[model samples]
Target chain A: MPAHIKNWSRDDLLLVAIDEGSSVSATFTQNTFCAAPVTVAKEHIASGSVRALLVNAGNANAATGERGIADARACCRAVAASLGIESSEVLPFSTGVIGEHLPLQRLLDAIPQAADRLCSNGWGQAAKAIMTTDTAPKTATRELEVAGERVRIVGIAKGAGMIQPNMATMLAYVATDAAIEQSLLNDWVQEAVAASFNRISVDGDTSTNDACVLIATGASAPPSANPQDDDYARLKAAIIAVHIELAQAIVRDGEGATKFVTVQVTGAASSEEALKVAFEVGESPLVKTALYASDPNWGRLVMAVGNAGIEGLDTGGVNIYLDDVQVVEAGGRAAGYREELGEAVFSKPEFTITVDLGRGDSREHIWTCDFSHDYVTINAEYRT
Target chain B: MPAHIKNWSRDDLLLVAIDEGSSVSATFTQNTFCAAPVTVAKEHIASGSVRALLVNAGNANAATGERGIADARACCRAVAASLGIESSEVLPFSTGVIGEHLPLQRLLDAIPQAADRLCSNGWGQAAKAIMTTDTAPKTATRELEVAGERVRIVGIAKGAGMIQPNMATMLAYVATDAAIEQSLLNDWVQEAVAASFNRISVDGDTSTNDACVLIATGASAPPSANPQDDDYARLKAAIIAVHIELAQAIVRDGEGATKFVTVQVTGAASSEEALKVAFEVGESPLVKTALYASDPNWGRLVMAVGNAGIEGLDTGGVNIYLDDVQVVEAGGRAAGYREELGEAVFSKPEFTITVDLGRGDSREHIWTCDFSHDYVTINAEYRT
Candidate 1:
């Protein structure tokens, strides 16, 4: 079973029925190669009101030139006409193959059916419909009691390949029934994504389309507290919780992946260095293969960390741990180390590998999975 | 039936011999992750003159700390002591597997027995011994008439993976019976490599240990005219021809490769931009898959060129030709372009992909191969 529920897994499209009091915001890919759908979504989200969201599977509608833009707009108009709202009030999302024109006829025919079945409660279905090559839909929801009134935040995301966040490839939608301004929601979503989605990588390739949207429907009672108060903390926590879960799911479902790994770099001179160190370790094929073989080869790990282009990293001060087992310390393999210890540590389906630079307090984390034969097979025969 | 000759196809280590009058020049990987053998070879090559070269397969004595350094020096010393030459004159090269101590005892035991069988002219034998996972040994030889004396330049290289040239991966040794100054030879070899070996990539990974050495044994008389004169053109041509052939052999032997591809980018704003555009197109997975499946997907070619970070690349000015058939022009699919033309173009065992930026006079050429399922299988299962 998926982490949340079944209703979402069965739905073909997302329903249009969140409460009227919601404010919507989004951040899209900044690449010059931005896709047509991304161009459309950015324009719609700028209005700060999203009455309903219409997303579909099986086509990404990217790289199809002007026709792609026209098709995406047409889908939104159809959804709005069904909901009896202005076309600008609906947001559309797509995930799947790139450089193909949208099947506008099929999508337009499905929107009325989708909006008619739209339910505020079907976050799970919304997640599934936006999936492409994703082994499972990712959904996370957290309820927080802020100022003695319950507030809930739900998030869903889909990605597996072409996933290395120069903003990583994927769509993430987080909705809440709270009274919040569009500006605040936008800032929070970007901040959360920067900390979570932006930190992970599966492949180094960046996609033409990438987006994260957050909606606040004002279904929950308004807090008496200001945006700077503990009420904001509760809201931020829910958003971050969902973002982290969705990001982890992307890693778990990483193409040709069998083991989930986390690389943490601490005691760095700056957050940037920490991030560089973490990503270098996360993306190394040697390190990934070691993870697959369940071999805690710290030498390869040290080699990767050393190559990260970080200045002034005292190699001697580096200490590496695999799932709490101290495998390397002080620029060398730990004494009394044995392959059996490494093998035991790697035997887990999920584990953490930590590197302490012993420099300062700055730190960063990267989540990824091992590269297996399946990744190659998928890519080699993809076009065929 | 090999590109060069029949007698050159097969040999064992015992049949190879070192040239006594050899003047050797070599360049090693510049990465701080330099392997132990790289360090030792740098010292040997820096010693002014080297006569004999000793190499062992199945262990790349790299990243093994002090022990690796000691082992590499020991191998050279063992060969020197047996050959009755100073240890500094014996250059050692190693390949295969990194970050582990070499089994020097086993190698030491094998060298003397192999040395007894060395013959003065066994270029074919030297080529075969250096191979790792290569289906065939690579050797390119050219004979040119200079000043009425025939000079033979035979070059050989070995590589299948971890091949991106910071210098050169796999060992390439070219021995010529041409009498030339070490200074001029060094300049000639470096310039030739920049145009040949440096223009290809098997994978983006640069190995820890990589060395390419050229040893010129001044046995033939000097040219009757100054080398700066056009009279030496035939000799220079021979060197360049051998370099190109040896470099292409590495590409032909690229791991899991089924098709060899040449990407030509022309009419760019600068040479750097042309190279950037060429490499981007050559390295793209989408383009590689199209090559693998023999699919005429010109959109992927345009996408790669645009993503190259090259500025002012008027998409409309872009033109892509798969062989003689124009698939994309005027920034879109060519009017009346046919898929059958593309298929026919790709069906050839070797073909050129030309991208015209129509921006400036700059151009570049890059060689690559299709990424197949075997590439993943070979790499993923290599260690196991």
Candidate 2:
């Protein structure tokens, strides 16, 4: 089933099959240039039903005019006809070069072979089939008891380059065997993704093909539809854990990323301000490069904070820490702060930066990675 | 004369003198954390009479609490005492690490020495002294006839990193021998900067120490102070030309930049939209890297345009070109486009990218540079 769609292959075409009559809820990229398949998927998902997904990796099929939409529709039709389902029941997805057409005939030809190899253990294979420039497959699973019934949740994601999802990642799929109401599943999918996938970044390029789909097969005893139920809360937590795990893995595997970084903004006036501060630090190239060199340059961090454009920001009341060692206290260098302490913390492969604005109790955190020369090399040579 | 009070040096103190009684107009960084010197310069320039500028390199004297203001005032005081002028008549500038106090004693000690070296040709040395990480001093001169009188305009600037001037560059000084009213000088300075320095970017990190000062010393027969005077237009044009030359030099010397790029956005609903779209493409790491690699990846350009947050942007109406070769027409790849054509254009040391929205008649342009591995290397190693 995992064929030429493998990473770095000449033709990154992918085909996969899933159970019929599955309950699915999904999220897609908010990028205005969303791909043709994203447009089709949004329209199809609005029907409140989905059975299968036909996805390819070589062409994103975006900005390709009316012809692109026709090709996506044709792909869905072929998949649905072969699987004995309605065309709208089969959602289509594409990722890779934008503004290119899909090789429909070749992709359709491989669907039969892919369907024959589908099995419960196809999660790992499917993960590989959907990858574009990703170096490794990203998958996470959790098993828990819901109302005394064994419930299982599995999630897979593929994003190594055009990251910084405004909604969800480039491509992600989560499936569960616990029965849940369609409406509740939709709400949980949105909330869970907002809490996890929306709180991480890699390159800050929101991909046009981003989509996250969650499916329920109802193969096991399920919890109540409402979160008021004890089992519902537990299942939600497990699902959230899977989402976070997959989200974090995307950052870890971020193209050319050398170090994992977590930025937490605390004591802001609101959650929005907290996230604004967090992104100001996460998306700053100066700060990222300094982190790459392990330079422990706290001034760059302060510069990023200043550029965050927070209104009425009391610079004098701000506090910044590299891990446990305080670097900036009350907006300036702490009285006894030493450069060596910061150097020691930043030299580590993973560290936390806590910025407390001391205005309110709101807090936000984001996971990111250091920018290195490899990042430029990878993106620069991607087309060549 | 400019002196080395560099950020990392043991001392980065500096001082310079100007003719007594100059009509001065100035602009400072809009960064909320504007440096202590910037705040004092803003107040001093409001008086329309400035005689000296005391600058340091090592510490930006920003985010340094009330003591930073006192330190800046002290430097100005010492300069004023030596020149027999009021402290308010002296402006201060500092560019280096933010949140660090100036070496008040060393800076005060150097004022007399700097004043002693003030010659008409001190422009060259002054440019070198104000540099923090700049590899070369940027200077431009223009001589023109205004109302049958010779008018000369000279400009010098220094900015290597953190060179995105939201208002003006890190530091730019333009002096003219044309007599003009205080109000006219102020209005013309704003207009000239908007057309020049404000349209260039390096890393998009608006520095805390940005300042541009324009002075008219009446050293030569001058044009009429009234804008309605025909000779005033020619003089303004010469001054604006000098500003652009000096501003473009900053981008040419952008930290580790290997190629210069000019991004032009046209046919938009408004000038604001044009600037948004232009910056979206100019600041994109993906686009910059592709340019660095000489890759004709127009899809990345399209992605940037889409992310510009333009309301009701019809992707089908957008057009893009690399140099003179049309890449995207009517939102998709131009019929005659070839990868080799883009590669050939991008392989050059400089080029232009023109984006046409085809929505209205508004247009805007920005000067930028390709992001390269050396950019990461330079910033990463700066602190070390």
Candidate 3:
């Protein structure tokens, strides 16, 4: 179910809190050019304790040298001191234009006042402040019956471009009130992200400041069964579900994106080969432009697959389909292929391109969006 | 020099002749999904003695099954019968919309009449017949004084997209009247093409039918001195000069090309690494679009250089320049860098991007064109 809680232009009561005895796990971008906020947050997360998070939009605070790091730290100190907690307990994040120095005095001056305005009711506001170019703030909540205890799991994320998970530029924050161990939560979050965020590519660029943190406050009543029992399964499922929704939202809001295109490669000789072909097909400008124009140019797809560095993919074994319509089979055009039919398939706002390598059993599903004039316009004028 | 003659539209007889006295050498696409033209061309060129070339535009006889082979043979037979030569002497080339079967009957009917209309002086006409989406036909001629005798070299080519020199769908024909041995001519042509045709890219796609053939009639009088003297040097230079002009014309006519861009990477640890960084910079859409918009976004250049798989490259030692302006220096933005200055540099219709890796001394060069809306337009609706 989707909820509408828009309009956060003035209210700044967005404060994150874990009611005490909370467990936390997080992962950040692996890019060597990571931003100052990402560096500070990861160091704080290493202590496995995060009581609150402060985030803002309009300045990415990346590539600004040592001064940027000092700005992020000062922000966390201001927020923590106002809340009467140790400075290490507060985490801060920023998103927006990179390579510009942040206005630290303004952020430092604002956070103490923001902490005084903290309320759990401001989850909606927290979602808004983290948004950059996203047209809508993405939020997902799930209720899970875990060993007779109901657990409330919610998540929020924001991203538009410089996205290709390793970890991707997209940032996700997931919170739940279930009692779980930190090591187990860490393992679970990594698995969930692997199946979701790691599989999507917006423009094949990995950003320098991508971070996702999952915090469990353990405020809910303990499970009726053993902690190591099947009771953990329900909470894990809930977290994975929320992650999927957030991941999908990021793809839908991709920079200058108009259509969401899913690429599913199946029957590859190996998962490596399947991923190679899938990435090639997803990244090809020719295929993306055709997708933008709503043209079912399957030849571009075939060309990309052929160019992927696979040694012995049988062209005869390749099969391509736009949705359920078979466009290519048995190494060539389908018997009744029609341009108009493909055009109709492409005209839809969303579609799946399923390619059967027909080689083995491994498969991969990659999510991507079409290349549009808007994408070029956004990136071409990004710095400006 | 450029010339004009009649015989492009298939109807004047002036010095028409066909002979299988010249040997042929070619390299075909390595893609397993290669089209029928590639398969047949490999067979025909293997035996050498490929003197006659029968080229047509408007339909690429590829992926059309057995009928493709028969149509190619029929086209050659028609041309050979008209000129009273063996059909085996004629090697055929086709360019244009691929996968559509060649209308063999229409072509076969037209070839005999076209051969009857052929004229030795119809260079312009022959050039026009081989054009697909090219806005203009290209022709180049050079005369050199070799061994006290005048040697002439003439060449023509056509290409726009589906270009990646693993022999892109580039078609080039060169005719010379130099008294060189068939073996020496084949060696020289390969060497010339390596530096000319094989080094240019349009859209980074390898076409199904890319051919560069040289036919030497050995009509020039004997040399005044040794075969291995400056006389040979002069003739080779003339041949290479013509090849370079033809190759440049293809790049100039690249699909939706607005400005011709040359990327030169030097001072790498190895030529392999130099080429790696050169291609990485060349293929990056961010760099290409920035070049298209003439924005001089040097940050994207730095990112691309880092992403290129060259190890031990000191980011601090990296330097970049657009023509004469130092855009990036010492691993970061240069001092006194201003957006307006970069804008001024990119405003030109043509410019050079020079990158110094600060490793050992190695260099490589690549030619490309700016990506534009027209490029998308041409490729997206290409088949239609």
* lDDT of all predictions: 0.73, 0.82, 0.73
How do the candidates rank by DockQ, highest first? 2, 3, 1
Each model's backbone clash number: 6, 6, 1
Candidate with best TM-score = 2
Better of 1 and 2 by TM-score: 2
Q: What pairs collide in candidate 1?
A: A8-A124, A8-A125, A15-A118, A22-A216, A22-A217, A165-A168
- TM-score (chain B) of candidate 3: 0.90
Q: Which stretches of candidate 2 lie over 4 Å from their true place?
A: A2-21, B1-14, B221-223
Could you estimate the TM-score for every candidate?
0.88, 0.96, 0.85
lDDT of 2 at B81: 88
lDDT of 3 at A138: 88
Query: In candidate 3, which residue ranges exceed 4 Å CA deviation?
Result: A1-94, A121-123, A178-190, A214-238, B1-19, B65-70, B73-90, B139-149, B174-202, B214-247
Tens-digit per-residue lDDT, A259-332, candidate 2: 89999999999999999999988988889999899988887888888888899988888899999999988888
* TM value for model 1: 0.88
**lDDT digits (tens) for residues B281-352 of candidate 2:** 888888888878888788889888887878888888989989899988888888898888988999999999
